[model samples]
Target: MGNKEQTFQKIIEIAYVMFAENGFEKTSLAMIATEVGISKPAIYYYFQSKDQLIAYIFDELYKEIQQDIAVDYKELTSANFKEKLLELGYKSIEAQGKDPYFNKIFNQYVLLAARDESYKSQLVELETSFLTSFVEVLQWGVRLGVLDDTPHIEAKAQMLALVYDNIGNFMLTGNQLNYRAIWKEAVHSVIQGGKDDK
Candidate 1:
């Protein structure tokens, strides 16, 4: 990367840590600049304000997490849909566990979204994208004649996404629950459309 791109990326990395450690309110541009060995104005050259920098951080983090857990949609089939979904769930948990600041940063963003429209909009878009992945997978299964095309696909996808989020939250908070089992059960239920075999 060029010097300017390197400096911009450095600023983002430093700012992310500071926000995760000190929070959005506590971390200032000056502090980030100091950590990055650049002038506060240098930060402005890349980001108009701390909020903008944080929004960028949120976008980048989301992309990284998505890439880490992404499944090959092109290769998806009915026989492997459940397995792929389980892998997605497990990989999501693994990715979150790999990043010590992920939960903290996510919580910070949640708090920011509570009062900031821009943050709220970005979060809504991110969540919509996540949900769309599940919906697309379900639709793909239906098209392949391997899974039922239930009318409640969207609702089911939403519930699955919620389960993943809660599982990550519980694990991060040291709740010590059987997350793998919980995740497997959740995936099974979604796949079965909440039916009871017995």
Candidate 2:
């Protein structure tokens, strides 16, 4: 790429490492610039502010995670949610484990989003997109007669996502537990129960 694009990418790379190490609050633009071998103004040429930089880093990273676990929407019509969701849980865990440092930045964004309305909106939008996809999968399972038809599919989807997320958080912290067993139990509980039940 050109110098401008190169510099911008370099900024993101260094900033991610710093944020992972020192956190968003402790990381500074000057520090990123120093590590990137650029001036503070140079960093500004690509980002308007520290928040913008952090936001950009998070957006790009989140997109990467999404791509890592991306499901083929066409495959959602299959009647095997038990296997599909189990695979999804495994992929979710892998996504978090792929970049051990991402959770740090993710938690930082959670706190910042709580206090900042703009950040909160962005975070909510990101979560909504993720949740919608998950809900679609569960709904498809219902249509295929593989999973119980629940009117509250959205809530069940959110719960399943949280289960995977919690397991991922544990893995991030080096928690020593039977993650596979726990993940299987949790996924089964969410999808095992139907409109046509006996």
Candidate 3:
């Protein structure tokens, strides 16, 4: 890479660590510039403002996560529905284990979204986009009659998302909380009451 490109990437890396550690409200562009060994104007030459930089970093991370999940879709097996889903969940959590900063950054953005309309909109869009894949998989499971549809497919997908997020949290922090087992039982006990009526 050229010197400019290298510097730009280094700035981003430093800013990512700062943002992840200090969060959106606490991190400052001056701190990032100082950490990157550049003037504040130099940072502005690359990004218009702190918000823009934060958004760029968030967008990149979000895209990377979506791509990671999409690629994992190919690894899913023909096992029983719940087992396959649990496998996917396990895989998803395992991926997070490889990158501790990602979920921290992601969670930071989510909390930032509460006070920033632009961030809120982007976060909503990101969630919807990611959920589409999960919804499709759940719909397929329902059609095959291998999964329950009691609370409905969409709700099931959302619950699965929550379970995965919690499991990821547990894995990242090494928390003693046992959310995984509870969520697994919840999925297994969806009651099979929709189209299958079991």
What number of clashing residue pairs does each candidate have, in the order they appear?
0, 0, 0
Q: Mind sharing the TM-score for model 2?
A: 0.82
> Against the correct fold, how does model 1 do in TM-score?
0.80
lDDT (Cα, tens digit) per residue for candidate 3, span 1-198: 998999899988988888877887888898899998999888899999998998789888878877755624444433456666655666666576676777777789888888889889987887787787777777777666666565677887777676766776666576756554655565665524322211
Model with the higher TM-score, candidate 1 or 3: 1
lDDT of 1 by residue, 1-198 (tens): 999999998997788788988999999999999999988887789999987888889888778766754557787876676777788888777777777778888889889889989889987887787877777777777787756778987788788888988887887687878777888888887776533321
Model 1 stretches with alpha carbons more than 4 Å out: 1-4, 39-48, 65-72, 192-198
**Candidate 3: global Cα-lDDT?**
0.73
As a whole number from 0 to 100, the lDDT of residue 48 in candidate 2 is 90
Q: Residue 62's C-alpha lDDT in candidate 1?
A: 77
- Model 2 Cα lDDT, one tens digit per residue, 26-82: 888999999999888878888899988887887887787677556775665544557
On the 0 to 100 scale, the lDDT of residue 174 in model 1 is 72
Error (Å) of candidate 2 at residue 56 is: 1.5
**Cα-based lDDT at residue 134, candidate 2:** 78
Q: What's the distance in Å from true for residue 170, model 1?
A: 1.8
Candidate order by TM-score, decreasing, is: 2, 1, 3
**Candidate 3 local lDDT, residue 36:** 89
Displacement of residue 131 (Cα, Å) in model 3 is: 3.4
